[model samples]
Target: MKHTKVKDLLKSTTTLQEVNAKGWVRTFRNNQFIALNDGSTLNNIQCVVDFENTPDEILKRITTGAAVSVTGELVESKGAGQTYEIQVKKIEILGDSDPDKFPMQPKKHSLEFLRENAHLRVRTNAFGAIMRVRSVLAFAVHSYFQKKGFVYVNTPVITGADAEGAGEMFQVTSLPMDKLPKNEEGAIDYKKDFFGKHTNLTVSGQLEAETYAMALGQVYTFGPTFRAENSNTSRHLAEFWMIEPEVAFNDLNDNMDLAEDFIQYVIKYTMDKCGDDLKFLEGRLLEEEKSKPQAERSELALLDKLNFVLENNFKRVSYTEAIDILRNSTPNKKKKFNYIINEWGADLQSEHERFLVEKHFKCPVILFDYPANIKAFYMRLNEDGKTVRAMDILFPGIGEIVGGSQREERYDVLVEKMKVLGIDEEELSWYLDTRRFGSAVHSGFGLGFERLVLFVTGMTNIRDVIPFPRTPGNAEF
Candidate 1:
């Protein structure tokens, strides 16, 4: 009989099940024991091989990470550490990896060291857990939206304009960076650039997704977004994935409802399918946060706040109200914020965001009608004249996981906002045409996909969630 996976066999304590297994030897110890893993999980299994019963030549060839096929009798070992192990009956070497040249040995590596080797980092348990959780979350996102009848739309990677209106954009080029066409201002003429006229990788797909949602009623785009920001923080990456869903006839409140439901469903799905992985991440986060008790264990801290959000209905606060709460709060003294959180006008920073979700409301906070001046140009202007129908869904550990707004479906208002923001109407003529033809009231939000993975898996760093991180100054992988 072919041996089953060691991890699977360990789950069942059945005796005398003959199995065949093929995997890399994780650790060979005490002359007769082999610790093996088959890219299953963080925990590998210990298989006790009786050398006297095996071919000496095969035994001699078996080295750490050497691929071997093993025929074994499953035994519920009366062992001290592991519950069950494979009793080897036969062994055959499939391939041998040179232990010296290979980066990974049985020895442990620092996370910083592993960061240097992002390519092969997936072989490690933490990365495996992260990758698996990321995969499951991506599925959950698609499944959640698809089941709700949201059409999937693939947005462009390279585009003529930046979506976020954020200036940080990576230049796309068919020509070499050094040998680019220059004009009178000694600037490379971007008209000759790929796709022409200063095109760069997209920063968000919300605007494009809106074009479809106006027609399709409900649509979403899940894909890569790029930025050229040089800040090397744990959470910021040059290239990241975002899930932006736009829904026609949806107001800001409806958008929040969708956001909350989407978040809850994703969390529940992750917890259900990747419980072991989640637990692993939980433990991992606990370890990671130990050094920053103030940051981790603050009143409106990440873990506690996320657990609260995951378990309960989110609290709603108007941005104006949130600002008032922050201004009048005792906790504001501790935040040491440069910007005043006095009233309805300020952009909520991480500190103010933490205050509302973690400290003030002590629940997930959906604050709406952010100042029109501070918000993106596409947001619908509220009756108050100062605010736009933009909402940010902020959680405890993470600040704003989602940013969305009800779009000004009216052509004139949208055109005016775009003009005020100095967004070129000539470039966005197609977008304006949607309003001219069949534009309807629609709202959408951009959920930083890495942020969700970070929140769900308890991963703190943006680098930890992505397989091959593309932070500024580093695209090695």
Candidate 2:
């Protein structure tokens, strides 16, 4: 018999005569009721077992985390929490779980504990909801780009170029580390590596995506990217996903518009499709926030915060203006910010970003025209000779949700910038070809996919948003 998903079974209008439901046993209460979940939804299906007729051995095996198949009549539940439940006629234990050994029992478990059991964490209500929302958000990302006539491009996972110029990439090599090959200068010989050159996991697909955008007019890449940074903060992940969209003939302003619209569209889509999951996450967040002081808690609920973003336009401020605002703000005045904004060229930290979004602007913000020295070499240099056409979209809770800029289309200017920055001209000759051949004014931005997921799910830690988070010293599955 085909087993029905818990999500579909719960939405059934008419009572079915017999239905097969297969799920992991969340709890077996009073030896009669079974709370079964199959990860189709956050809600569990209550399977009432015939404990009197069932053998003691079979009943005893129905433990938490046990995989069970229940053949039952679908009927209106007498339970208060749920409407429909299964009246079990037959039950089979597909996989037995020892109650004494199962880590995830039917109780509240700390997120830290669940992180250790990352493989089994999704079985919990909170993680299940988060994953579902994440799946929908991913779909929404592709949907938004596809509907707008954007071609989805798969950029290479391994590349010799560091797109972000951060130089914090995980090196991909097949050469034996024990018997390392050395050059005449005693440096490691990368020419003998698998790719016949130094290569690493891509940090961003923006540079590659730009090449496709130059020809295809519009292109976007959604793929995994790696960073070898050692920071073990809530926001930093060694491995994460990035969404980079490159478009032709778009300037800094156009890029900002595209980013704002794209983000709002995806957020609205997730809210529409994952209503139940979002509600669960919102409740989870509220419950978790109970331990915090009123001042530290979020002012708006999860749903309300999402709705607020959709209703209002993100406030746009120049970087110079933002620096002035930060320098005169309460935090800087009271020495609250860890990295105080003392001057114009200072990079804005998370605290400064939060103040602009949550305190000063009281909405999402777009800070543009950053100092050229601080931004990447690919960004278009402004006429002021000091700033570049770079922009960062700042959210209330998440500091920089999206970072992008109008790319430098002039080949001469790009080469000069690369020369000054000591970037290899020969190494990125292919990227420069986009400018060499028919480089029209183009723009693109990269949205850290995990950051978007973090904001939408209201998850504080970036690790929780992505499955199998790879941090500095921890790579446990």
Candidate 3:
């Protein structure tokens, strides 16, 4: 608590001017030297100490991940490689860390190894960069929405079912799984679940967002969204953060603009607000590693793309054109498509989406009017008898960062669409009733917060973005 935060260290003339700064040991070397990163700046303040001056007990207590505070003089170094360092006056022991027990160390390790110890991984340079940038991106979201007069609404996480209708929900029941009663069809009776009515975590907050938007005129909900799908992919997490902004008296076009502007704001915000953290990552991969893996290369490319796209405009492409373009492309392009997106009705795969945005548009492109059957039921139908008013903003590396649409404000159309989707109508009375009482044209979209972090920070895995990732077969702390 007595130490300065890592962010407060800005420049040598400013923070380094103190010379006698205190911080924990990120790593050590030469038995007489220590690297102190106060977590205030991207650069760590290197401290050189002779073993004679430093106590054996203090050195014995110290480890790679140990927490220590050093009071030292800022020494300007112009060695063959090194530029700046700190001359130690004395070092104090704030906490002792055992190297064998500490999860992170100076030696190179895989990201998978660190995922097992999330709580401790923040001490690492890469994760520290990611976590700090995540904080910045989240702040950017709130700042952008609030600055535009958008009310931040906290919607209910528990309620009578009726969100995504994915048939995937964790029963919040008091009864033991073995003791719960079953229907004649052998399904567990949800009546035995908590609240007596069926309920689970929400997959999306759009409906609740729309309700708030109707009253507040413009509202946004940023919270946790849960899905029960047992997916093992890097992009799929059972629990993740979602940002949904709803606007009343707006259509799909307005919604797209909002999504584009908001995304640009987040990326630019991270670059501006978290310049130090990103610079740390850039140095680690670019300078230290010589070059990075393909994924990391892709990540850097995206940061460059975001910097340009945020300032420029976005390209708009229709579903029909996207399909035709995919169909017309040559067969052998060494392109790895997750699935075929040719023809109007085929569901767009991640690969196809990446192609359209990265290849065709060459920038962040807004792909609109997706096929009705493939999209959510709330999306407004198109006059072309094929697509819905859904706009997905796809950037170069990450595909489909934003998924949103204009809702069918007309009660009759909404009800019909629900029927077609096999959803019962009576259960959603509160939502449907909104239509009866001045539910004007409204639009909103959900941007996966983790996806935004992955894009901004140049981290590849979604598991690393979330501190405790809940994924298939893996929920380790």
Could you say which candidate leads in TM-score? 2
lDDT of 1: 0.81
Q: Considering summed lDDT, which 10 consecutive residues are worst modelled in model 1?
A: 296-305
Model 1: per-residue lDDT, tens digit, 1-477?
555765686687577877788788878876698888776666676778888767777777778768888887778776787777788877778998777776767677877788888887777778878888889899999999999999999999988777558658987778677788988899878777666677788898888888888878999999998888888999899989999999999988899999999999988787787767667767766666667857545443334445687887888888777777888877665556766665556667887797777666778888887888888888899887788899898887788999899998889988888887788898889888889997788898989999888877676678878888887778785
- With candidate 1 superimposed using the best TM-score fit, by how many Å does residue 128's alpha carbon deviate from the native? 1.6
Per-prediction TM-score to the true structure, in the order listed: 0.92, 0.98, 0.90
Clashes of 2: 0
Show where candidate 1 strays beyond 4 Å: 1-7, 12-15, 55-57, 80-83, 105-108, 176-179, 182-194, 291-306, 333-344
The lDDT of each candidate is 0.81, 0.93, 0.77
lDDT string for model 3 (188-292, tens) is: 777666677677788888888888888999999999988888778888899889999999999998988888878877788788877767876766555533465
Sorting all predicted structures by lDDT, with the top scorer first, yields 2, 1, 3
| Residue 91 C-alpha lDDT in model 2 | 99
How far off is residue 100 in model 1, in Å?
4.0
TM-score for candidate 3, residues paired by index? 0.90
Location of the lowest summed lDDT over 10 successive residues in candidate 2? 160-169
Clashes of each: 6, 0, 3
TM-score of 1: 0.92
